[model samples]
Target: MYKLGFIGMGNMASAIQEGFINSGYIKADEICGFDLSEIATEKAKARGVTPLSDGHEVIRNAEIIFMAVKPQVVEKVVAPLKEDLKGKALVSMVLGYDFAKYETMLDPSTRHLTFMPNTPIAVGEGMILLEDQQTLTDDEYDFIKKAFESAGSVEVLPSHLMGVGGALSGCAPAYIYMVIEALADGAVAQGLPRASAYKLASQTVLGSGKMQLASGLHPGILKDNVTSPAGSTIKGVKALEDGGLRAAFINAIEKSMGK
Candidate 1:
């Protein structure tokens, strides 16, 4: 039996498989996945994942199953496997979907978990948010945490805060990418080559984030440290403030959470 099973072999599911394999946490053979798309299953097979014929087959052969399909079709995908999921831990990566829905759709004895992991997981530098409906045992919880941590940081939050946490961490990579692009564009406007600009801008953001995490200092303080009296950094900071950068980001998160 495979240790991990995926009901969908889309991008997110592929990312998780890559992360786990790259991290040496689990070998590719330990995973089995099934997708309606033949192309997707072929891709999974190329990555050493055992590709199954259907979701029911995956559920039967794997200990832990991840529902990586779209939220709207999740019920349809799992409904037929109600019997196979009994006493198994089923993890869902669908946004805005809750554990109660899965419990009602699947067998009552099925254990459920909701996970929110971003695309960065493919690179082993992602942020993962987790919420479980009190179904995992101590060992099960630790195993799941360690599995995800191989790909990036892991935070287990109250179910009530999953949406907020998902917005902050799950949506953050895109926001950061936008910031990187804007910074690169500004550099290009100043005569820097596009490729060099992207490298510089991305590295700067990456370093700044690492510094913040390592130092445990307030971001405001870190900004202040970089902004010298009448300096270029301060000038850029002023430009951002003038453009309502902070407010724009705050609004973006609120909108993402459907607030």
Candidate 2:
């Protein structure tokens, strides 16, 4: 049997497979999955993932199954697999779901938990948000955690915080991508070449994030360090403040969580 299986082979699913395989946590041949799209199935095959005939086949051939289907269609996709999933560990990437919701969906004997991953997971620097699992044994949970940690940082949070955690980490990448684009545009406005501007902007953001994580310093303190007295950095910071950048991001998160 394959070690891991995916029910959906869309962008997120493909990215997760790439992450796991590249990290050497699991071999490509050890993974199996099924997607309704022929193109997705072909892509999986190209990645050395065993593409099964259907979700039921995936369940039968894999030990751990990742459900990355859309939230709206999750019930439709999983409803028929109740018996097949009896002893399996199912990690769900579908949003707007919690343990309580799953209690009504899967077999009681099936071990499952919510898993929130972002696009950056395709690389080895993503954030993985997992909800504490009540049904899974300690060994089972730790193995899952370690497997994912090989790809990115893993945080197991209480179910209550899963939504916001997902928003902060999962949704923030798009925001950062937008910030990178805007920074590049600003540089281009200052006569820099677009390609060079984008490269610089992207690296700056990456370095800044690494600095904060490595130094364990407050972001405000880091900003202060960069913004010397009457300096250009301070001027740029003032412009961002004037443009309500902070409020915009805060409101964006709130809107994302449907608050």
Candidate 3:
């Protein structure tokens, strides 16, 4: 029965709102959104939620506030709401931003939760990380957990690791999509239809990922188990090695974190 308001109607916010509605955790009317664009407002209304004209209006109406605005705008948006934020549970999906940062901007009386959920949450396979400030009560934490569980799996992490966890999860979706697309392209190069190649490549990657988790085996060991002497798997492994696929993935992570 909590009233939730998202200050940004961007993709991540929309994804989460879609999850809440689809999972029956909250009704459309229980959720409200504020976006500066008329198109964005109309888009939110189409989803059966109220579209607010100003960010402060959403704060005034909500018991829970989702700070889904971009990192660049977070400071400006939260600054004016400091006095109006009392008694609300503030959750943020903005990357490169942390709970301490949000705590400094909001009312000292409000409960704070820092979260970073991946794009998969839109499809119910999302990974979520939650970090709370000093003000969280037992009941507040429970409600936060329940609200996120409606979107996907939620895990509590040390506040110090919040940014790192978010960088590795929230921003890694594009990397995964790149790998998936590259794998399908390779299959197509071998004379498979583009559609069929994508189907097989995606499903294979998904099953392999499930196996890695279920079996708790190192990815190298899983690769070894699948590759036999004089087999096609061995040839594929050789190709990946020659192209420096592993090194490229490592470099991608380093580049993402500005290492």
Candidate 2 colliding pairs? none
lDDT of 3: 0.82
Any runs in candidate 1 off by more than 4 Å, and if so which? none
Per-residue lDDT over 100-194 for candidate 3, one digit per residue giving the tens place of the 0 to 100 score: 77666777788887788988887666789987454667786787689779878887888888767777778788888888799888879889899
Superior candidate under lDDT, 1 versus 2: 2
Ranking by lDDT: 2, 1, 3
Please, what is the TM-score per model?
0.96, 0.97, 0.92
lDDT score of model 1? 0.89
Best candidate per TM-score, number?
2
Candidate 2 on 15-120: residue-level lDDT in tens? 8999988999889999999898999999999999999899999999988888989999999999999999998898898998788899899888999888898888
Candidate 1 weakest lDDT stretch, 10 residues: 98-107
Best of the candidates, lDDT: 2
For residue 50, model 2's alpha carbon misses the true position, in angstroms, by: 1.3
